[model samples]
Target: MGGYCGYLATVGGLAAGADAAYIYEEPFDIRDLQSNVKHLTEKMKTSIQRGLVLRNENCSENYTTDFIYQLYSEEGKGVFDCRKNVLGHMQQGGAPSPFDRNFGTKIAAKAMQWISKKLKEFYREGHVFANSEDSACLLGMRRRALVFQPVIQLKDETDFVHRIPKEQWWLRLRPLMKILAKYKTSYDVSDSGQLEHIRVSSPW
Candidate 1:
């Protein structure tokens, strides 16, 4: 979920040429994380069994009891108790914020404009193309959308080929590797409590 949010935030920032980014993560402690992970892993394994039992019984009371039992056994009593006051209904009751409504309208307008422009460009290129039924292909709003043709074979032979030159690959990877090394060193120090053992290596 963090990764997905990060990706969306990055794309939105890049599209708007924003100066900075903000990030958020699910609130959790080390113990909470461990408990959640263990519970989820075990629950997944028995999910099919529970589903089958619920289907066979076909009673709301039995299904509810089984679900509570599963949650209590795996995630402990806190989660089980909390489930009693579930916020499922409250989540759907809020009014749409002004920002959300404005953003939605803006995105729709931009999508229509982009699709119209792409259609015009495609026709002007004198390339024989059939109208696509797929909204995604017809819309041409994908990441790096303008860099490729609709035909897969043609796309591969055109600008898509060698888009990343050797120098470009090295330029991207160098800083990423450096950051990874720094993180590794920091992690080692945190784990062993040995500040002197941490060493930095130059990439030259």
Candidate 2:
């Protein structure tokens, strides 16, 4: 039931050891700060049972990307199947954009500075600050500047949302993503539809 938030969940899920993840983004971005790594784990292991398709056999469940795409299509009937759908608004996978790379450098530098400052303060106080919930903080970019805030101050202090907010802002589009599935292949009138078709229609 989320857009970019759903996508980033896949990203974080992949980093946390998922074989493959699908990120669906589309119009009307929304932000749901509640999703986190623990929620992801719970999603994978829950009361609902999922079919595990074996080689040379088809299952009733839709686990593949194609099936998910169908779920995204107009016929999907608002199936929040995976709470994952629609990636028209998702970032294309590739090398980092120059802006993102540069932003990363700045963010890393700021975080390092914060860490160093905290270490110095700890040394002065003769105490080690290792994973203290009260001392824990989230680093982010705001107004083009890196800022640090204590985790206690945020309703969500999860590692995912606290550090990266891209998906959060796009969460609202999750519903539209499912609906986009209807328009997926209905419009292919462009000369560049050959490549653009795949690019726009499929969220892969």
Candidate 3:
């Protein structure tokens, strides 16, 4: 948990809460950073206002668009009407990419394999083996196999760190997305839309 927290902070910044939100939302690895930047930049260029609003709303659970609105409004930033620009249901109507399908399959397979192994281990340990007559024991077995029971479930121990705030994370990485767009990095849809290169020429 300590290690995971540090990794989250290093990857997504402190704005990501201690929860597993970083796994789904924040860029935790170099590959993730590159992929995320490419996706975000493309979205921004196609629809800057909409993209920015989505990012603001979903960047972190703790730091919301409302929080930003209040903070900036106090400093004379005018009210932003998100309703007009919101895509709403349109965002959910996209086909799943090959990457999504492949990754989902892989995770499902791994989870099933883990569950099988855990059940075997539990049986070998000679824990009270209730027969088919015992539905409660069967349910307990399922729970033990499928549930993620951490060795230490303390409140202070989280799977995310607090190195950079969420807002700062967005500020720093958003430019990288713009740079990728400006350079026209290849985005092959079939190949999981990976960025082919991010070449930076030295000014020397």
TM-score of each: 0.28, 0.36, 0.33
Q: Write the per-residue lDDT of candidate 1 for residues 70-139, one digit (tens) a residue.
A: 6445654332232232222353436789976976676677777767776675574666354663323422
Reference-based TM-score, model 1: 0.28
lDDT of each: 0.35, 0.42, 0.37
In what order do the candidates fall by TM-score, top score first?
2, 3, 1
Q: Which stretches of candidate 1 lie over 4 Å from their true place?
A: 1-82, 85-94, 124-204
Identify the runs in model 2 with alpha carbons over 4 angstroms from their true place: 1-4, 8-94, 125-134, 142-144, 155-167, 172-204
Better structure of 1 and 2 per lDDT: 2
Candidate 1 vs candidate 2: the TM-score winner is 2
Q: Alpha-carbon error at 192 in model 1, in Å?
A: 21
> Which model scores highest in TM-score?
2
What alpha-carbon RMSD in Å does predicted model 3 have with respect to the real structure?
A: 13.1
Q: In candidate 2, what are the lDDT values of residues 124-191, reduced to their tens digit?
A: 46677565564588887667678788777664534453233432543343333223322222223244
Per model, how many backbone clashes are there?
Answer: 0, 14, 4
Whole-model lDDT for model 2 versus the true structure? 0.42
Put down candidate 3 lDDT per residue, 18-74, tens digits, no spaces. 111232233344454344334444444454433232222334455444653443244
Q: What residue pairs are clashing in model 1?
A: none
Q: Is candidate 2 or 3 superior in TM-score?
A: 2
